[model samples]
Target: MVEINSLDENDVLFGVVASDRKNRWLGMHVDHDQTPPLPWWMSNPNQMPQWTNFLPGESNNHEYHGETRVQMRKPTGKWNDVPCDKKLKCICEININ
Candidate 1:
């Protein structure tokens, strides 16, 4: 497993792609804590949230290119469908008092 200790705010999480025992491309996000911004296409045209930050490209292409995005929100559970070959980006945050 790849471990990133220091990540910037602009970094995008990467996921891997691999065939399971059934020979299926498991395309899923492994890290749920990092909630990448939803794409504009997926968002509502009439209503937009203040925190909307959709990436320029599509999630499928990101996976095809061997790259995944780390979401801002923390994950609640693990994704069993996530492939082994996908790569994810992470952001490291620190508070200064």
Candidate 2:
């Protein structure tokens, strides 16, 4: 996950990645369970608001990446999708059950 366990690491990484102006890959990916697709994290039974979070004009827009997958831009933390092929830094989260 982009969120780090250590505060110092978080600060350093946040500054470095945020200034780069590139997408940070999320560990979660799209699953076509419904319209606009859903990321793995959202699909979890406990997760709510699964069908929302698409910014204005963002859902399935295909403007930048035809094979759209989830991405999050730094600072603003806006959720969006980009091409699956584009290489970017990754954010990971561990789910305990």
Candidate 3:
């Protein structure tokens, strides 16, 4: 997936080359830049760094884009393995009784 700062025509074009998207919706593209950091009370006393996604040795279609994947938070409060390039939010809520 291509994660861009904003949605544009290029997203559609890239999707076509990514995989077989035959009349299927991939879902909305969102970027969550307001994720809260770890609270001080339960934080590490020693040196701590912000959450980041990195590929120790993963492959990507883009040659220049290596390692250093973007962070994605899912509805379940879990980090999802999505292309850091695609500007999309991972969340889905359905009420049930």
Candidate 4:
């Protein structure tokens, strides 16, 4: 099991592949089991939207090297996904349970 950490608005997440999601909204799907966004002093706790690049059985962008961006963080620090082809800085959190 893996969870991509959430970021606050204006919070920068490095190393992300650029994605061309329609309207630049980022590829998204309804995932009921995804973790909630992190809560900070100024961050809102009510907006933990779950999103993913790959939509199974759905047509999607197959651009660059990575058509499906597995893990990504938006510059706004919100939950988002990007193209896996673009290379950029990113952070990973590993927890042992």
Residues 1-97 of candidate 2 have per-residue lDDT tens digits of: 4323344544555465578876576444555545756455433434433333444665463753554466666765455667778788776565679
Compared with the true structure, all predictions reach lDDT values of 0.28, 0.54, 0.29, 0.33
Model 2, 72: alpha-carbon shift in Å? 0.7
Residue 6 Cα positional deviation in candidate 4, in Å, after optimal superposition: 7.9
Query: What TM-score would candidate 4 get against the native?
Result: 0.28
Error of 3 at 92 (Å): 20
Off by over 4 Å in 1: 1-49, 55-85
TM-score of each: 0.21, 0.51, 0.20, 0.28
For model 3, residues 1-97, the per-residue Cα lDDT tens digits are: 2222233432443354345322221222222221322211112224322332223422222454332233223221112223445554322223368
Q: Which residues of candidate 3, in runs, are more than 4 Å off?
A: 1-67, 89-97
Looking at candidate 4, the ten consecutive residues that score lowest on lDDT are 36-45
lDDT of 1 by residue, 1-97 (tens): 2222223221333221121112212112333223552322112323323332233333333344433332332221112222345444322333459
RMSD of 2: 6.1
Consecutive 10-residue window with the lowest summed lDDT within model 2: 45-54
Q: What is the lDDT for 75 in model 4?
A: 34
The superposed Cα distance between candidate 3 and the true structure at residue 67, in angstroms, equals: 5.3
